[model samples]
Every structure is written in structure tokens, then in C-alpha cells.
Target chain A: MQDNYQQKILGIIGGGQLGRMVIQSAINYNIDIHILDPDENAPCRHICHDFSHGKLTDYDTVYAFGKGCDVITIEIENVNTEALEQLAKEGKKVFPQPEIIRLIQDKREQKQFYKENNIPTADFILTDSKADVLANADFLPAVNKLGKEGYDGRGVQVLKSEEDLDKAFEAPGLLEKLIDFDKEIAVIVSRNEHGELVAFPPVECAFHPTANLVEFLFAPAQISDEIGEEAIKVAKDVIIKLDMIGILAVEMFVTKSGEILVNEIAPRPHNSGHHTIEANFTSQFEQHLRAVMGMPLGNTGLRMPAAMVNLLGEDGFTGDAVVEGMDEAMKEKGIFIHLYGKKITKPFRKMGHVTILEENVEALKAKALKVKDSIKIKA
Target chain B: MQDNYQQKILGIIGGGQLGRMVIQSAINYNIDIHILDPDENAPCRHICHDFSHGKLTDYDTVYAFGKGCDVITIEIENVNTEALEQLAKEGKKVFPQPEIIRLIQDKREQKQFYKENNIPTADFILTDSKADVLANADFLPAVNKLGKEGYDGRGVQVLKSEEDLDKAFEAPGLLEKLIDFDKEIAVIVSRNEHGELVAFPPVECAFHPTANLVEFLFAPAQISDEIGEEAIKVAKDVIIKLDMIGILAVEMFVTKSGEILVNEIAPRPHNSGHHTIEANFTSQFEQHLRAVMGMPLGNTGLRMPAAMVNLLGEDGFTGDAVVEGMDEAMKEKGIFIHLYGKKITKPFRKMGHVTILEENVEALKAKALKVKDSIKIKA
Candidate 1:
């Protein structure tokens, strides 16, 4: 039988909303896909051409799932790297290859790699003993953060006073001074295997204040061109140093002097680039898969000035997540809502996001604020 | 079992590319779906959560497949209306409802309904016997079209000269004069169950001169405001008259005398509205689902000026299909490519389309022509 569709399958290791969205890109190219995830009802299952319901990290599941595809990719980072490495050794394409995945899986290795590569980062003392920094009275109270899997403010603590120092006893990790900055920002940069790289405009990050998850991202950065160039340069240099072959979203801190410092990196599509779906010519998820597959990247031009507001589960809400006022909220011009289709949600869990695209910055900001207030993810 | 993630299961009767595209919108809301089509590997099969492979016209299949859905709809016009009516009688929610489906299923009934409701359409005479038309002689050299299931230049014929008239001596249907059309345009007007209606920017269409199917659609239709308003009024009137609670694509022809006349109407997403995916604030497919499901209608504002060029298979190709130069065509700024995942090729088969978005009409038109010439669909 002759197979007519020319695009090869892009196998994704996790079938969450990220994978679901990645499949959206694959659909445009008529690319066949095989998805692996634990849930039979995983969001990605809806669109994946072929799906295997199993743990993403199960070595057999990951390896076998990869064998049939021309390239293997991932939506989440928790997949087992050893299994991926074995597959890569057998000539299956795994991007953000197992080699790179290995370097970024552990926070200790990730931070140390940055240090070894002479990348500018906050200086921290890494130790196996959590008591070392606190017991050393000479050591001023500093921030103690776990070197691995620190997500959504979990495993990270701000230690300012003497009394708060006891909290550091729980996480046996590194201690560094918390950088005082004006605003948080992130840049979604794409680098193909051949070294072609392009960066979307930096997005100004606004945290939830309480939840610590990025609540909103304002596009076009609203910063001077000089600062924008500096940010993109920093992101480009990070990609070059990491030898990244796909999209690497570089999150950073902007100092009072408008200097950008590297904060973290995500090998796949990042939440910060969500605005690109409706605001930019090419979405980050599409760019990541294209770059990894050695396919030509799309235009990253801005389609409109936009802002993205994440929808987290409201506190005390758990089952059968409901996006209230969504119908009413979406009536506003330029507002685009994306519900993740997750059934259950713990408090602060990412439920969805709403993007507003318009030309008038002030007017769009006003509407975005209204949309943020009107729409709620609750049971 | 209390279904946590379940919102509503929408069953679509046809599994063609339009149904495949509709699945995309339902995916956005994480809506469960059951698509019934005969092909085992139908393009819409995997994208839909639960798809039962069956023929739409089969009574048992149509009736059973729609039992579990909250509301049932269709992308194709040809289906068993009796089965749908039976389901509706049993309290199943079917949009374009059963009555509307029954009336539109046959050409004779459709023409009668249009005339009774004063809907402007081409003058026609419906006669099954070719002898009746020949005996009349006045209907000779007429535009003879099928009363059912005609699409994309198929099931339609134009009797131009005496040679054509003689061949029509054994034709199956009656005919009428071919009205010289000025400019063809389409209005994607959506109406919810609540009677709320919103019209997308009218799209001006140009035919292939040979294929008869729309070759391109220039959105933000470069016509006078009066003509645009008239198109919207016609579309809205059709929606109201049909009492169709979903999207309706009203195709019209502006005569050489500037008089607008209805050409045809599709009660579901139409090819002429494909440009809305990237150009409009709300895509027609999503809006269709929303409207039929009784959800609040969304904004239909144009995000940018867009032009869509269809991808039709060349006449000589007939095996496995391939589209060349896609990589280079979509690489240009403001160009968005959509592939229908069609494998087989025949003369004038609808393959896919490319939408170019730019504020400058001249620039967009130039890009559209280049896109049309650059990409070739062949077997």
C-alpha cells in the first residue's frame, strides 16, 4: 500500500493539554502521530492519530512508542531519560535529545551546567545537607531552593528572617540570595537543528501574587528596543550554549537597570509563549516540532499586540471544573479562550488561558482585566 | 457514573474534511464527539473522541450513532432525514433540526421552500423526466443542476449551445437559463438557538474559469458598504426563514446590473468561509458548534484582511496525492496553510487551502497568486 501523506509522525511522550496542542500543529501538516500518557481520557487523546494509554516514564512504553515514529518529542519533562537515550542510540530521533534531557532533568545538573558553561546566573552554594547554611550563623538568611523539579513555587522558599530559616531544613538544596528585580519576563526562542534561531518578542510576566504561577503575560515587552535586544541576545546565547535544537523558552529577571538574567529554561513549548497562538504568525508549539524534525520554521511575526491570562482553579474547587462566565467573557472583542478540558483540578492548577489581541494597548489592557475578573474556573 | 469531564457529545453525520475541521473546534472546548462515517480511517475518526464507522444514510447507523449525543449535526447535505426525524421524535436534539433536513434533502422540496419563503435564488423548473423539459423546449440550453447531493462542480451542468442542448435530450433533470453573474460572494452568518445572529466579513469569491468551484476568496470583501449590508440582510433572512439554529453559508451572485441573487446555501460550514480560521476573531466552525449548542455567539470581527486560495488536484493526477512547494509557500509572512489530509487525487478534488493575511489588499492578492502557482497538487 502506498502511503500518500508525506509528513512523518511526531510521537509525543505525554498526552496532556500540551500534547493536545502539539497535535493541533501536526494536524495542519497532515502528520500522523502516536501519543503516550497514563489517562485513557487524556486531553491529547482527543486529537492524537494513535494513542497508547500508559505511563510516559515507563521505559517499555516510552521505547516502544518511539520505535514507530520518525521523530520522538515530548510535552512534559518528567519522562525517563535513560529509556530515551537507549532509543536515541538505536537511531530514533528524540529531541531535546536524551543527551540534552539528561542535562536539564535535574536542577543540580542544570545549574551546574550553566556554571560550567560560564552562563550568568545567581551564585548559590549547593550542598547535600540542608542544615549547613542555617547552622553557619555567618551565612545570612538566603533563599533555599530544591535543585530539581521546583515548579509553581513548590520546593522554593524565600528565607528572610531568622525564624524563617527553620523552613530551609526541609529541602536539602542550594542557598542563594533572592534577586530583587522590577519585573519578571520570558522569551520563547526557536532553534532548528541546523542552528537557525528566532525569538518572539519578550513577554512581561505578571505573577498571581499569591499563587506564584505566571498569571498574565503582556506581549511586545513594553520595554525599550535596547532592552529587547539585550533580552533576545541573552536567550540566543543560552540556546547556543545549551546546543538546544528545538524551542527553548528562557525565563528571566529584569533588574532596575533593565539588565536581563537567566532564570530557567524549558526545552519544549512553554506557557509563556501561549500568546503566540493568537498573537503571532507562527505558534511556539508548531515551531518546536518543526525545528526538532528539521522542517522549515514558520514566520514568528507578531499578528497583533496581545496579552495572555492563565485560568487557574479557584480555591475550594475540585471536581468537574466549570469555566463560569466564559460565554459572557468571550463576547469582548479580541478575547480568545482556551479551556484545557481537565476534569478535576486542585487549587491553583492551570485550568486554561484567555488571550486578548488588539492594537490599542490601553484598551486591550482594560478588556483583559475585565476578562480576568469575569471568567472563573470553579466547580 | 458521574461523568466529570463530559460537557456534551456532538455527533456529526459526515466524516469528510469539513467534519474533520469541525472536530478542531469541539476539541477547543474539550467537547466529546461521535463521528459516523463509512471509511475506517476517515480523517475525522481519531480526532473525534468516539467515532462509529457507518454510513450516514443508513437508518440504523444514523439513529443509533446519535442516541448518546447531546445534540447531533452534520457537515454534508446528503443524509437520511427519516432516521434523524425518528431520533428527534425520540427526544434527541438534532440541529438544522429534522424538519429542515427533510426539506433540504431533495431539490424539489428545497426549491419549493425557497419560493414559498420568498428567498431569492436562480429561476428553476424541477422535472424528473427529460422528455418533459424537451417537450417544453423553452427550458433548452439551460443551467441544469441536480436536486440533491451536488457539490464542488459535481452534479451540476450548463447547457450552453445547441450541441449541449441535444445531448440534454436524455438528461435526468430540468434546466433554466444560465444567469450571467457579476461577482460571487459568500456570507457566513451564524444564528444560535436563542435567535442571536452574527455575520463574518463577507468573502468575495472568484471561480477557476474551468473548475467552477471557488478558486479564491478575498475577505473583508472589497465591495461597497451598501452591497455588504445587502448580503448580510439576505443571509440573516435565510437563517430566520429556515429557522436554522446554526451557521449558514449564503452564496450569492451580483448580476451585471448590480442586482444580488442567491446562488446556493450550505446549512453547515462552507469552503468559502475557511479564511475565518486565522482572519476572524471567531472561526466559523467553532461558531457553528456554539450556535447549534445554544451557547452565546462570539465576535465575528476580522483580525486581519485575509485571502484564501484553494488547492485543487490537477486533472491528470489520480493516485496518491502530493502538494509540492508547501514548505516554501508557508514560509512567507502572513501565510497560513491548511491541508485536508486527503490521500487520493482526482480532477478538481478539494485538497486544502492557503490563507494570506495582510492589511494591503494588493500585497495579499500578490501573495495569494504566488501561493496558487507555487504549490502543485499531484499524484
Candidate 2:
């Protein structure tokens, strides 16, 4: 088994920071990792065993890259799934499966998946264009989401009233009911080819006021036992239903009346699980590797309560990255800083993250906020 | 401070497993690491930011490597100190200062320094040749050690009696009286240029019956509080006395009568502290980086009891490496395996290590032994 693992060449489709971190874990197994990304200077370029500069969505490029790999995976979800499907047909192992990737590539399909599968989620209406969104003014107070190519905070708009309909996407999209929730939480679940599945404890996310990205996260979310269990069950069910083999991050909203609603899901290691690196028995990166490699899932128990803070570039910086107050943050105990090897900083760009561990959730939150306030990424 | 850290490039003298692990930690800081080693295919070659294929002991190679680095350190102490001394004179920060490296490179000088500083250590006499060792016939049952170029379990022999004298070293070396100790423990301590010092809890080591290298290690060594405290104090004192500005591992013997005697010392991360990667708040690899970077020492508190088992190559095999029973070992919980990227296997070679974490020492020990017995490396 070990010889087979060593001989297997694992190819990752995106050579960003996530791929870089996964390669870091892969090194422990002595597994050769090949990376494909358009950026020649991607963070994973220097560390990966092999690197090919090409478009992740280019059919020929993706097919050629997968030819030499015994098993193929991805750090990002925007890669060409058609090529992966062909590779799968040719006997190469493509984890998370190409069909599932195709289903997740469009918001319309994702929302439809939840509804058809009887998964609890907010009500939504499919829209062909801005005209279709404007036709149904009754769903005025909904979120307009582009069906494809929408990432981060882009291609999303709050259509709270008729006047706001101008913000609706001009392309195919959906109008999802705006959920009034008590909190935003995420649960990461992983499944292996052998049918083994495991879920990391749920974590509550606090979004940046205007950036539309997670700013702080507390593990073992401050939710009721029933809610946490429900979140895990829902997450596990989604993966099992998709029959996907790998890690998935399921984001949800806990409404004020105690209803759990699915918000979004990522079919790979997510920002929500970054704290696992230092606070859990097994890091999510390692768990992803094991799941895809068909190895037994690791113990997902928490070593200690942990809080994670994303280190985003300051609003006004747009040149070579400069980290401020790192010294002060390091002076605090139980603080682990991870800076992505990105040389430049732009407003709200994810430059790195910090994980804070404590004996209790309260202390972890306090330390996490303090660390967030102290460290700044600037030009 | 962060800018200074980012701009600074770290040069390490050895590109083996130790340097590879260090580079793994250094990557988190986005710090550029340049590695120098004789083997072109050294384990650290790919991951490091820069790699130079050259002799570490060659003054020109070492000097040229140091010229591009803002800070110079070593993963192995066999580097040419003269080059480091010159680099230090020219304003490069050479951690574990050249003078201290020189002092530790020879076993004779190490023993003498321990005695001069009133540090508790086994008594020993410097010997220039085999004749000098034979002159003291009454010093039977002593251990003869080569003064220089000795590493791992090499360049040492047991002089149990006149018949064993033939195994004594013939070059400049030392004859040390061996102690009948109840347990062998090691403490890893780190000091920064700012005079800050911190020590990890001592860990007990069990050497292989024939390999002479550590076979298994248990953290928070099952020793009395007094002995543990004494061991820590002795380790800290050695670093302070030497005024070294980097991490050091001090191996000591705990006599049955409760006396603590220093056995030897290593200037870089040692095998005994490998368990810290998963069991302690701060891993030894990261701690070494923090100490040499002049950053504040992190919390070295133990999160739980842990045991580390060194993965050694099986005897009677020498060829392309093949690992056996890894699948069975991964079936167990709380097992973290780290396989160094060495393609070939030789009898007794350090192949990798497994760190086992448990709620209690008894369970940790049981799991560790089971893991040790299950995993095998062969060719």
C-alpha cells in the first residue's frame, strides 16, 4: 500500500495557496504532487514536485496535465470538468467526481439540487436575465446571484425593493430569499472511496462588515447541541447524496426561529476549516488527502477550542505586501500565523490567516479579535 | 518587523530531513529559505526557496551561500564554522554563533565546557589517540567517542573491558565514564537574540537495542517533578552559559539516585522533540524558526500526552524503498506519520517517524508501541 501511495502521482488543478498547503501535507507521505495553473508564479510552483503553466479551464491543457497523474484533485472548483470526466473514463481517479463539480459550477443547479434532494434551504426562483428578475417584483427582497462565474463577493446583489432590481444580474442567475438568521456557520465533512465519512465540529463565522468574507471564526459554534448535530447531518447527507469522495464545506444559516437553512457549499478544503491545522487532531488538508487517497479518515476531535482570523489586505494598500504589527501579535501565546507567499497586497485580498487556540471559546474569541486588530497587511 | 522578516532570507547549511522540516515551517511565514547541501537530490531541494548544490564544509561554498542570506543557521552542525565566523564579522546574523558551533562540533570540547561551567555531566578525559585511551587502563567500562565528524550512532564504541579496547577510536577523541541511569530524557530549549528563553517539557527516550538511535519517545517524561524541573534547568543553563541564540537539544541521564547528568547536546532540532509537532502547542520545527528569526518564543505547553516512534529501515534490505503496513497503521486514531522523501532504504536508516497522541501516558505508550511494530520500511 505504501509503495502504491508513493508511486501514485497526485495532480492538483489549481496552484494557489490552498494547493500550496495541500502539497505541504502531501510531502509527509512522500507523494509527488503535480500542479496546473495559469500563473507561472503561483504559490505552489516552487514546492510542488511538478508544475505545468496552463489554463485550468482549457480542455487540452487539463487533459494533458491529467495524463501523467495516477490520481487527480483540485484546490479550486473552476477547472474544466469535461476533461476530468474524460480522464475518469480513461481510468484516472478524479476525486469529488466531475458530475458533482458540474452540478456545483452553477448556482441554479446547486439550489435545484437542494430542493430536489429535500435538503433544507431558502426558497429560490430561477431567472434567465434581469428582465425575468424584474418580472417578479413580489420576490423583491431577494438576493440576485449569478448562476456561473460568481466568486467572492462579486455577481451578487441585494434586491430589497423595485428600485434595487437594477442590480439584478444581466445573465442567467437565481433569486434566493434573503434569510434573516441568528448566525452563519459552516461544517466540513469528508468521505472516502471506501464509504467512510467524518465531520469536523461546526464553527460559527463572523463576516467582515463590508468585505463579504469571513473575518473571525469560532469552533464548536455557540449553537445548541441539536443545531450543531443537524448541521453535521445535513452536511454529510449532501456529500453522500452527491456520492462524492473528498472533503466538502457546507455553509448554513441558523434563522431566528431555530430553522437551519443551507447557504452555500464548497467541494474542497474551505476557509472555515483553517483552524484545524493547529487545533484539531487532523488538519483538513491532511483529511482531504486521505479521503482522496482512499485512506481511513483521521480522528476529527478537537485538541482545544480554536478561533481563526483571516488576514486581509488593508483597504488602501495596493503594492508589495507589508505586514504590520506581526511582532505584537507573536508576543501573544497560542497564536499561529500563516502568510501566503503572495508578494503584493490589494484591498481585501487574503494575504494570510491566524489561528488562536485557548482552553475556552470565550478566550479564543478575545485573543482572535485582538490578533485581527493588531496585524495589518499594507503596501 | 514583518517587513524585515519578509525581506530577510534564511540560509540553512544542510538540505536533509531536518532542513526539509524547517522549510515546511518557514513557508508559513512566507520567508525565503536557501539550502546548501552536497546531495543534489536532498529532501529539501524542492521545497526550499533556493537550493545550492555544494559542499557544506567547503569555506567558499558556505561563504557564498551566506552572502545572499540575511540570517544564516544550520539544520546540521557539521558546517564550516570559519565561513560563518567571517559572515558574522561582515554583519550577517549567524545563529548558534560560529564559536558555539565550533564548541559543539567536537565531543572533547563539549565535555570540557560542561565541567568548566559547573554543569552536571559524566566525567571524561580528552584523548589524542588510541594510546592515550589505553594509558588509562583502569578507566574500563568507559565510552570512547571521536572528537569530530561523529554523528548519530557513529564514531563511538563501548570499552567494557580490555577485550573491547580494540573497538576504541584511534583519532583525537575522549573517553567518558558511562553512567548507570534509570532513564534518559531530553529538553529542547530556545533562546532569541533579545535574551528571551523558553524550554519545552522534557521527554523520555528509549534507544533501539542495537541501532543506538532513539526508538521511541514519550513527552512530559514520566519522571518526578523534581527531576523534570532539574533537567529543564540544566538545559536552560547550558544555552545561557553558551549564550547561543537558537534552539538547542540537551540530552541528559537521570540516575536512579535522582542525580541529573548531561550526556550530550545538539545545536539544532533533534529527533527527541518530534512529538511536539502534534502534541505540543508549538512544534520544535516552528520553535527553531521563531528562535532564529528573533521572534518571541511561542507557548511550549503540552496539549496532551504523546509518544513518537522513529520509522527505521528494516535490516537486510538495500534498494529503492518500500514501506509496508502503513495502511494498517493508518487505521488507528491519533497517528500522524511523517515520511522523509528518501527513495532508497538502507538498514537502520531514519526513514520517518510517527507521533501518537492520547489522553493518558499509558494509552500513548500502548499506541506508540503498536504503531512501531506495525510500520516497516524495506527495499
Candidate 3:
């Protein structure tokens, strides 16, 4: 029998909602979690075993934090990869390998990697500035995306024609042909150091018109068996190709021509998989912990049909969060609400989410919509 | 819309594993949890929003703690009920009701409550001392229990005959007739202030030979439909009779003669219901939060057949805990491990638990046994 076992300490870079959820799962395994974030009042500050207030991109701060942990991971990708690479070289387990994080940190590199790897994706041309994008007017009706430091809907614009090109970014970016897709979906997959891989079923997503963020997600995406199988295969292939260890969310688009194309990917627990906390045997948070810890991946099977609705801050409201209709929304059965403990709400800020589970997909969808309308996060 | 919404703070009496798990659920709702416990290093010390290192049984400590919270509750029943009663009088919500907690604190009072309410229970006689028990030789083959401060297997002894009377407690206690039980089952019930009640399906429990604590629990107890319904009704009736608000665990014995009797009851989360974390749609922890918060009760439907095995410290081991076979145990599919963040291990101490879910009952039982035998906690 093992004797005098010492528990391993895990260090996370960002202490946002994702880190908060990951710490929730880590508590079950008796693992001590240390979080480093710039915000002193980060969502995970109070819950983690230790919280260090520091910038994630500061090399000295990141290296100092990694020095005290046996395993290092991240909740957000915008971190110092050089420090992580040094830590990995010193034998600390840094998941989603620092190299992969660097590749994903730049949207241009991500697109080029996809093309070089023969992955199915929309055609795109790298651009140095707005002038470069304008010169590619022949590639009109395209989407212009900044190469780095873009998040949510920021640093992105649609150049439907030459006139729309004026909205293009001045910094180095990319112009990709915009395809009219029938639907958007995401698949979350995880891999461990032992080469064990598991993928959750695809979830269809609907974006908010103004916020440009996922508004609703339906698990077991409404697609044929063949399409679902292909999606799973493609997700697995991407992870294997990256040679990465950790959870990766692969967002894809399905065109009217019945073709699937890669859109974007995140190397941590993604919003698209939040419903798994109540609808699947293994939640994405727990799965991420298992993958990074090199434990056996849990069963990623769905327990019930589910729909998730993002609880975003109401427009024109930015102050102490006041959650309305929580009591009324909770009166409905099969509804689980999760607030990020953010205290404050900004317009379109992701405040929390509500997950609805039902035997009938239609019922799940209807309940999800009702929940979205009933609850408002305002000042 | 809710305007200037103020979040409520919840105060808990104990900061052990139960409180830790409760905080895990409370975090999802963004509810601030404050804990009061004498142990400065309690498992919940790190996770709770606020923690006061003080005795739960101390009137002033509990009262002061409750005064700061909008709602107050307990993870253990040995707390100062007078303080809770005072809190309730001052318009604070003290769930499980102080009166009910006081009644269940003493074994004698609990037995009298069952008798007065016409609740089916094994025949028993009140005893004040060892001599009092010896005087009742005619009541041979009974069990003796202390009136108060007795927990786990302590202050309880089986009096198979007059010779066993010497083992009886010298303090005021009770003598209960021994039961030739076919199996032991427990049903957890919850009630909100609105008088809404819900009961989870009965679970069959197997006790450790020496520990006298539940070692294995199987959900959807293998009992007749009539017995299951009867057990559920009895559980609901007890909670309703107490006029209590929150979760109550009712332990019962099913005699070989096809009769069900109430054995004991706990006013908080019990070991018998830990499997619900993964096997049921709504976990007992979350259910308790909802009941006490006066939110709508969640669906307690079973998601899969499940078995839970408590991870007890090895009999001959003590000091820092060392968990062996965790890697092997995790290799099995459908297994969820929960390790209470206890740094030390003592003989028979509850260190953690493993839950196994399977489609087949036999497979679940086999897997549970394998997990129990495979994992070893030592110093």
C-alpha cells in the first residue's frame, strides 16, 4: 500500500469563471489549487487554496507561481508561454503544452496550422494591415480578424464588400472567406499523457445577435448519425494532431451543402460544455482535471437531453449585479442556475448560465428559452 | 425585475465534509457561506466565504455567527439549539428547525417522539444507568444507547442477554429491543417552508462488522414496491410531523417478518445518500440548499443504478493518510471518487468514498466490492 502520500498541488494561470469551476471539481480529489490572477477579487479568489494577485503575462510572476506547483494549467490561453516552457523543462506537468498555447494564441497561426495539417477549414489569407486587406478586394465578402489579443467579438469585423473593408483592422490580421453556414456546433475532447482520448457529443450553438456570444446551446446536436460521427472524428483528429494534453473545445460550422468546417478552438473548458455539469456522467471541468492529472478519462456519455442559456448582463447596465426572476425561474423543474460570483455586471458580460434537462428535446429547448427571458442580470 | 438585489448569506454550524460539499453547491448559486467550527483547520475553512473558528455547541459563538447570516443551518445536530431558536425568533431562517434538532439530539427523546407520533419502531424501554438496565432482565436481547453526545457507533451496545447488561451506559439512556432485520434501508426527505415535500428512493445499507457505520450503500433498495412506498411515506410523514424545513435522513430496519421500523434519524446530509451526487438528477447537497433557501425542489429521479463504498482508514494505520490503488480504482469506468480533505488518518475514520454506476445491479455490486477491496488508505 502507498504510505505517507503527499497530495499534488495544481497551479492555474487565470482565476476567472473557468478557474472557479475547475476548482469546484478539484476539491473532490483533495487537490490543493493555487490561482494567479490580476484581479484581487477574481471569481476563484475566495475558493482556491491560495490566490496570488499578479498578471498572467508577467514572466517572473508566472515562473514564480509555477515553481510552487507540481502540475501547471490554465483557465485562459492569454498567458506567458515562455515561463510555462521553462517550467515544463524543469519537469512540472504543463498541460495543453506551452507550444500549443503559443500556436493558438495567434489566430493567423491557428489558421495556417489548420491549412498545413490538411484540416478542413474556410480559405483565408494573412494580412499585415487594413491596406493589405483592401488590396485583397478580389477576396471580397470576407471576414477580417486580428491576429492576436482578440476575445469574444472584439478585434473582428465582416468585410461583406469593398465598402465594408474600411472597418478592417489596421494591425496584422487575416481575411477569410465568410461561408453561409446552416448551423454552428462545438465538440469538446480530452487527451491524457497515456494517449487516452475521449470526446463528448457535439452541441449546437446559437449566437446572440448583438453580443456575438453563444446565447443557447443544445446537447446531442440536431444532426444525422453520420454528421455526428464525423464531428467526433474531426475533434479527435485535431487533438491528436496538436499532440496536446488537456481539454480542447473545437467549434465547427455546418454549411447548407452538408460540409463541416473548423471555426475556432479553445484549450480549456469552454462555454459550449457547461451543460455537461448536470446532463452528462462526466462534466467538462472534471474531465479537464482528469486529463491534466493523467487520470483515466471519465465516461463522457450524456445522461439527459439538455439546453444551456447564457445569463449575460443586460444592455446599459453596469454596476453591482442584481439578479431578477431567480426565484421565479427556479420554480420550474429541471433547471440549474450557476452564477459566477462576479458581484458586478457589465453590458453583455457573461454573468452565469442556466441548464435545463428534459427527456424531450423540444421541452428542453422551450424551457431554456423561457429561462433566458425570465432572468436578467442588471444593476 | 429585481432592483438592487442583495444576495443572502448562509451560515453553517459545522465545517466538515458535509459543509464542504454544501459550499460546493452553494458556490453555484453565488450564495455566500459562513462556517462556524471549533476545528481551526476544518475542511471547509478554505472554501467558505467566511469562517469563524469557534465551538458550534457554544451559545455565544453560534448566535454571533447566525446574527451575521440571513439564513442559518447545521451539518451536525450536536450544536446549541437554544442559539438557533433565538435566531429563528429574530426572523432568521434556521432550517431543520431548532426544536426538531433538539428532539433528535437525544436518543431517548427521539424514541419517545416515534412512540408518541405512532411511528412504527422497534420496542424499547428507557434506562438511566447500568443497574437500571440490569433490573430489566426480562427485556433481554435488546440494545442500549446513551441519551446524548453519542455519535457513530459509540454509546451503543447490543444486549443479547442479561450478561450483556454490564456493557450498558451508566448515564441516562435507553434500551431498545434487538431487531432480526432482513436489511437496513434509509430514505432521505426534504421539506421547504411552503410545506412542499420530496423523498428520494430508499437505499439499502450494509454496515461494517466492527465500525457499525454504513460501509456500502445501494440506491433503489432491493425491496418490494409496497415496502419502498411505505418507507417513503413514513419518511415524509416524519418530516411533516416535525414541521421542519430542510433535509432529513430517516434510517429504518426492514425486519425478516416483512415489517419496517424506524431505527434512527439525522437532520442533515447522511452517509447513506452520498451516492446521489452522481446517481441521481439532484444531489442531496443541492437539494438541501434548495430546501433551506426556499427554492423549488429539484427532480430526485434516479439516473442510473449506483453503489457507494466508504473509504475508511485502515485499521492499523494512523497519521498522515496515504491512498493506495487510487490509480487502479480510477481506471474503472463510471466511478466517481470523493476524498474529504482530511490530512490525517485514524482507524475507521471516514476518509473518502467511491461511487460506482452501472446499468446492471450485479455489475454495480461487483464493481463496488472491487473498489472497496482495491483501495487502501494508510499512514
Best by TM-score: 2
Say which candidate scores most in DockQ: 2
TM-score of each: 0.96, 0.98, 0.97
lDDT tens per residue, model 3, B1-379: 5622237888999999899989998888888899998988888988988989998888998999999999888999999999999999999999989999999999999999999999999999998888899999798799899999888778788889877767888999998999999999999999887778999999999999877899999998999999999999999988988888999999999999879899999999899989998888788998899898877787788888999999999999999888888877766678888988888999999898999999999999999999999988888
**Steric overlap count per candidate:** 1, 0, 0
| lDDT digits (tens) for residues A303-327 of candidate 2 | 7889999999999889998998988
* Better model by TM-score: candidate 1 vs candidate 2: 2
Assess each model's interface with DockQ, reporting 2 decimals per model.
0.49, 0.68, 0.58
lDDT of 1 by residue, A53-101 (tens): 8887788888888888878888878888888988889988788878777
Docking quality class, candidate 2: medium
Candidate 1 chain A weakest lDDT stretch, 10 residues: A1-10
Predicted candidate 2 versus true structure: per-residue lDDT over B1-379, tens digit per residue:
4546878899999998888888888888888899999998889878888899999999999999999999999988899999999999999999989999999999999999999999999889999998999998688789999999998788888888899888888899999997888999999999998889999999999999777899999988989998999999999999999999999999999998999999999989999999888888788998899889888788899888889999999999998989988887776668899999988889999989999888877888888888988899988
What is the total number of backbone clashes in candidate 3?
0
* DockQ metric, candidate 1: 0.49
Tell me the deviation in Å of residue B234 in model 1.
0.9
- Backbone clash tally (model 1): 1
Off by over 4 Å in 1: A1-7, A135-141, A169-172, B1-6, B136-141, B167-174
